[model samples]
Target: MGRKRTIKRDTVLDAAEQVVMRDGAARLTLDAVACEAGISKASVLYDYKTKQALIKAVVERRLAAHATCEQEVAASFSGDPDAAIRTRIEVASHLLTEEDRAVALGLLASLAQDADLREPIARTYGERIAQVTGHSRSPRGALLAFLAIEGLMSLEWLGLHDWAPEERARIIAEIGWLVDQVPAPVSAPASVLSSSPERSTR
Candidate 1:
């Protein structure tokens, strides 16, 4: 008889995450994951057929967790289209756990190795931008705000610089102010609205 499936997939994925976090993504192997999970190699294979498959699963799981957090934040705004952008800023400014940061680093390593791994992240960003523009009365202002926030985050993620806590707080506050600065669409002047082309006579 075939061996029964006993280990949960989340358990295996969590083990894989830890392995990636500790040893680096390049060093992750079935044996390493099996040791981390305290499961048989066959059990690991049962859940994940190959290392590439496991890496994909890790990306999916991380993305899913992120989506859940974004959804929760959006829900707090009660259907506001701008909620996602606000939520992103909130999340970025909040203190990140070592585990969260490790997972991000792991994902980056995976992305470096496989460009395809970035598609899900790209798609999520695209969706969030669409939502930001859709809700803002001024699409350009919203886009600018979004780009500015992304730039700050990229700096942190790339280890380019670190700001003091007070500096970060000030920056977040300023970004929030910028996001709220989206103005309502302008209308034509009264004269323009009332004017009509004079009848052309030969």
Candidate 2:
């Protein structure tokens, strides 16, 4: 007897992403994914019971990959007190790609229509906000930088703006400068010398 062909869950997810990227999320269906994967619909169903489940898997997988990239960026800034905000800026500037933006837009389209699927994304953002604000020496400045970075990314993801490379670099450099302007904590002054002989040095 011939052995049955097996397909990995990631294969299905990759097919699903291609469908969303090519046809938009509205057209993503089990049969569409199966066709894209070159597998039987039953095979796709074996892994993901519903379209929502498949999309959620895609969203979670992408989030996990991004988290890994963030950790790597954070590691590069070891011993830096402002690593959280710095890493976020670096990731926004370099790590994000055109494909990432497309996937994000696709996911956003899917999540916007389904509140249930949006839960994980909302939780992830909340956690990221807390991390950026908590680890910074200047919480307000960190929050502002974070918001600005998010806005920049949002513009690209939504196809609202296509900044030239130089323009984007200048914007990011300005944001970095803003972050640098956050004042460091003031150090306590040295104690004054006492007039008494017991306290005075020879």
Task: State each model's CA lDDT, in order.
Answer: 0.80, 0.86
User: In candidate 2, which residue ranges exceed 4 Å CA deviation?
Assistant: 1-5, 181-202
Which model scores highest in TM-score?
2
lDDT score for residue 66 of model 2 = 86
On lDDT, the leading prediction is 2
What lDDT tens digits, residue by residue, belong to model 1 across residues 1-202?
A: 9867679999999999999989888888999999999998998998789888898889889889978987776677776656766777777777566687677776677787686777777887889888888876656666777888888877776566778999988998788777767566788787775674653233
For residues 1-202, could you state the per-residue lDDT of candidate 2 as single tens digits?
8767678999999999999888888889999999999999999998899999999999999889989989999999998878988998998887357788787777777798898888888999999899878888887788888889999988887888988889999999888776656646665454533555667778
Shift in Å, residue 147, candidate 2 = 0.2
Off by over 4 Å in 1: 1-4, 79-81, 182-202
Global lDDT of model 1: 0.80
Weakest ten-residue segment in model 2 by summed lDDT: 187-196
